[model samples]
Target: MPLAALIVITILAHSAFNGSRVTISLYALSLGASPLTVGFFISLYSALPMFLGVAAGRMIDRVGMRRPLLVSTTVLVCAVALPGLVPTLYPLYVAAACIGTSFMVFHIAVQHMVGETSTDENRRNNFGWLALGFATSNFIGPVLSGFSIDLLGHRETFLILASLAATSLFLVYRWRNQLRHTVHDKPPAAHGGAIELLRIAELRRVFICTGLLASAWDLFVFAMPIYGTSIGLSASTIGLILGSFAVATFIVRLALPWLTRHIREWTMITLTFGVALLAYTIFPFVSSVMLLAAIAFLLGLGLGATQPSVMSLMYTTAPEGRAGEAMGVRSTVLNVSHTFLPLLFGGAGSALGMGPVFWTMAGLLAVGGKIADRRRREVSAQGSG
Candidate 1:
């Protein structure tokens, strides 16, 4: 299959997985769950991934993406359907964790497959397309999820999402041959473990930046429903707010070739933090949906441009034949924040106020932007010297 076809499949499959986050959030809240409890549910999505990320990556390196991708997609199909089967809070807990873990495996494999197949000239561009797939799915997921829940109720929405995954499963099975990588015959990179990969200064810097951005991204997804509910926004309205953010990401990623040509990756990362910080700083002060969505759009423009650069940087910087491992390690770094931030922000939001939660994230973004800017300066100095 062509890269474009795979990207199309990715958008189709991921729309369900990504959009489920909001549906799950709204469903949990409709069940009388508190903010802190909702945080716990969101946290469950990252719990297993935090622990198993590296092993999944290494498994991909040792075997191949085809098997893992197939197995993981199968699991995701089951995971997405679990809630509709049971239709209870407990089932959602199981579903959230399973969905997160399974998608982690599937995502890492797809990324590794994409990176390994592309040459240096188009590697970044290809990842941009991949990232664009994610942005499109992100938009489709939330909007479709929001409307689906409003029109059909949550259980039916889950079923709809599951059908999408089942469709993806069929496609993956049909194209199974193309999924195998050339790297499988080669020996794995020599290093002690993930620790050795992290020890490299470049990877470490990207990891730190990745973590901060992940925290920002997770908080928005996990917190948006609660935040919108607190302000009495309808389910559809809240989804639109989230959808606006995704649209901004789509618009930015759509312009990546031009953006990458004009701006450096680390430089772009720094600007995203600044954009996110400004968004968070304004988030708490708004009550109207239009105002909120506008702010979300601004933040999306900032963070939307990040993934391709980050993935390209890691793939290029990591030790030979270890791109999968590097991607997995990135997941670990991301899930660490994904694992903890919902509870941290949820509790703070409950105890103090939404203002405090936004402020705290703004503070983190400030520090992250500084770190990214320093790296940008260092890169410039080295180039000019």
Candidate 2:
């Protein structure tokens, strides 16, 4: 298949998989799991990816994207399907883990392919388009999931997601040959372990900022449904709130080329953090659904730009032949944050209620915003000098 077709099908499958993220939390709650337990449940989604990311990256470098893509889609089918079949709390945990692991593998391979295909000239532009695909899915998934739950109920929704995953499987198999690169590029000279990639100061900074931004995204996904429920919002209403975030993300991604030309990338990262801090700080104070929707949209504008920025920086900063490894390392950091933030905040929320949880994230984002700002200034001064 052409890259365009691959992107389209992948977006469809990804949207399907993402839809489950919100519904699973609500389903788990219905099964009598506590907020803390739900935290652990959400953590399961990242735990496997947290550890396997680097290895998966290395594997893609050695072999190719085809096998990993096929395997991941297959696993995705099982992950979403099993929940519909079992319809229990334990299976939801298993499903979350499966979805996380499979998607991580699939995502790493797809990103590696994008990096491999791009030359230095259009790399950032390519990543911008890629981020658009992701933003579109993020918007489609949660809103669809929300409405499905409200209309069809939870179990039925899972089955629909499974079918979506299956479509991805079909696309991958059909395009398996095209997915492999025919020509190989020279590997980076250092050619050390994955850890060696971190030695590059710029890559290190990218990882740090990526982790912070990615974690904030995770927090909203994991916490918002719970918070919305507490505030008496229906599943569809909660989905609309989250969907609003996706819409803003889509808009930002569309404007990214212009934004990149004007604002510095590092400055954009810093701005996102500050914006997120403000939004999270106000989250607890807002009672109206429209107010919450507005906040979510603002958060989306802040968070959506981070992915393309971080991925482009990582690809450029990575040593030759190590783009996949760098992608993996970034994945590991994000998953680690994803895995821990929920567990920590879930426990905190259980004890202190959701207000403290959002406040804590706001505090963390404030610190990250400062660090990003400092880095941006130092880069600007160095360039001017």
Candidate 3:
């Protein structure tokens, strides 16, 4: 039941996310907003969410999963609906902030729920399934949004997303009793405040890894489309290339259960970062849309493999009954990268060209991999003792 609910929520949330950048950009353009204004709005969506993630996590722990999840979903539905009703830049900015805030709450709740429900032995597989659900939704979202945008226009796309988000509320409502009883009913002995969550050494490693990985991921996803267009690719081609990445992500996540069982978490993360480094290193040299699609697929595979492992590692390290707070801190760290890296990439792209941006990302990924590898050895040594 929890898995089913999770899948529904993933589909709704991922679709909205996939569509949001393109839809908002187009909507803002229609409203006579300058490029700088559009960029500011987009950056707001990324930045605000990081700040909210920590608070949202606390809310989930305090109230239990169902209420926060429901509230977040409600806010998301309303946020999605606003673009259609207001049809202006300022209102859309407000909508984007709301969407960011709500998504942070919703994701933290879901991650906490998954952690609470699973044992350490099974947490990796559970998170892998969760990642799979997210990837599948990402796969479906862009293609659906592209066609919807073409067929119904951007205004209707927002309305459609709003409706989709509303469906998540239904799923959560149905599972409310189950989630509450499962997570909140047997509260643990009081722990220190949220700041103390930072004291977990293993969790610190997870956050460090998350921030680095997220930087690479956001840099690639945000910059690639703009770079592709600049190089004269059609919208359809860009969509196809993006879709290919999503499909590859889905394939990797499907195999993650078997993969996780056999491979150590650090080994998996190291491998992912290595592959990602290769992908970014070569990405700038590819000109053909078809070739771009192939590179994207490889990138997606590498990127997709890392996240669930990282998340599982974090959850395993979390103190009993404080999973929500731990996951929230992780989310905050991850989203902080998502918020800032794109701006840095954008600025670099403006100054040094896209080639430099790719190389810079590649360097970051390589460094991240090395750190994860080192930490893995340390952890293994400690475990053996």
Candidate 4:
């Protein structure tokens, strides 16, 4: 019942967070911000998270999930509500920063709960369900926000997001007692920290792959709005394009348990990145919204599978009593890319064109995948030896 409740909580929270994400770029543009400024807004969303993610993760490990979860959800209500009240470019930046920081708190806590509650036999499937919750919310959030913006305009759409966030807070508060408290049998060794975790070669490989996959997804969210606008797509059309990607993600996540049974995780990761390379390469050339949606769906299918697999690997690889810290480390790496890549892409989009930005991201993912595969082979050969 607790796990089920967690899923429900995640769906609402993720829906609110993603709804903000899918709209923020367009909002920035609407308020007279350029591509470069939009990048700043996107990067600002991760700046606080990038710096404080590990500390936040450690806090979860030290205290428990319930408190942080409550706090973050409460923060989200204010965060999503801010832009609606002010409705300006500066307020959007404040909204981005708050949303990013608050979500990081909420996410690391939930991941810790999921890891602590599940065992080896059921971990993969359990995480799959969590991923599905995220996918479902992703589908709902963008589409709902898109339609809301078309009908209600931007300010009122943000109101809807705040309402969803408020719903998440209420659910967590109601179920607070049902969520179990996990006490580590022994304290984690103080010496190692995130640095020591990085020393394990297999874990390192997982981080690299996960980071690349995460950044690709982030770039897609940021780029799609600008790309859609460039080709004269409506706000509603852009929402559908992004929402279709989420829908594809939802379908893939539903099949993940079965996919895990038949396909090795690394193999799946490699294939997904390969498909994404093709998707991004073709993204800039397509002008029709339908074609863009089709490509986005394909990209979503690949991107969605990578998460459960990589997250399971991270939890499995983490040192005892330190899963939260490891999850934070994962969040930190992703946020670092989230922090910088958008700024770089924004500048590139302004100077060169969106074409170069897409190709550059594809090339990075391709190279990262090859490195991951090579590292896996080396690890395998050593195990046999």
* Best-matching candidate per TM-score: 3
Model 1 clash count equals: 0
In model 3, where is the ten-residue run with the lowest total lDDT? 180-189
C-alpha lDDT score of every prediction, in listed order:
0.86, 0.84, 0.80, 0.86
Candidate 1 local lDDT, 159-250, one digit each (tens) = 99999888888888888887755545464446688998889999998999999998898888778898999989999899899888888989
lDDT of 1 at 120: 88
Against the correct fold, how does model 4 do in TM-score?
Answer: 0.85
Extract clashing residue pairs from model 2.
Answer: 188-320
Residues 42-127, model 2: lDDT tens digits: 77888999999998888777667778889998999999888889988888878999899999999998888877787676666677
Q: What tens-digit string does per-residue lDDT give for candidate 3 at 77-169?
A: 898889888776778888888887788788888877777788778888888888888887776666666788889888898888887788878
Rank ordering of all candidates by TM-score, starting from the highest: 3, 1, 4, 2
Provide the global lDDT of candidate 2 against the true structure: 0.84
State residue 237's C-alpha deviation in candidate 2, in Å.
5.9
Candidate 4 CA-lDDT value: 0.86
Residue-by-residue lDDT tens digits, candidate 4, 27-117:
8888888988886777777899998998887778778788899999999999998989988778888899999999999999998788778
Q: What are the root-mean-square deviations of the candidates from the true structure over C-alphas?
A: 3.0, 3.4, 2.7, 3.4
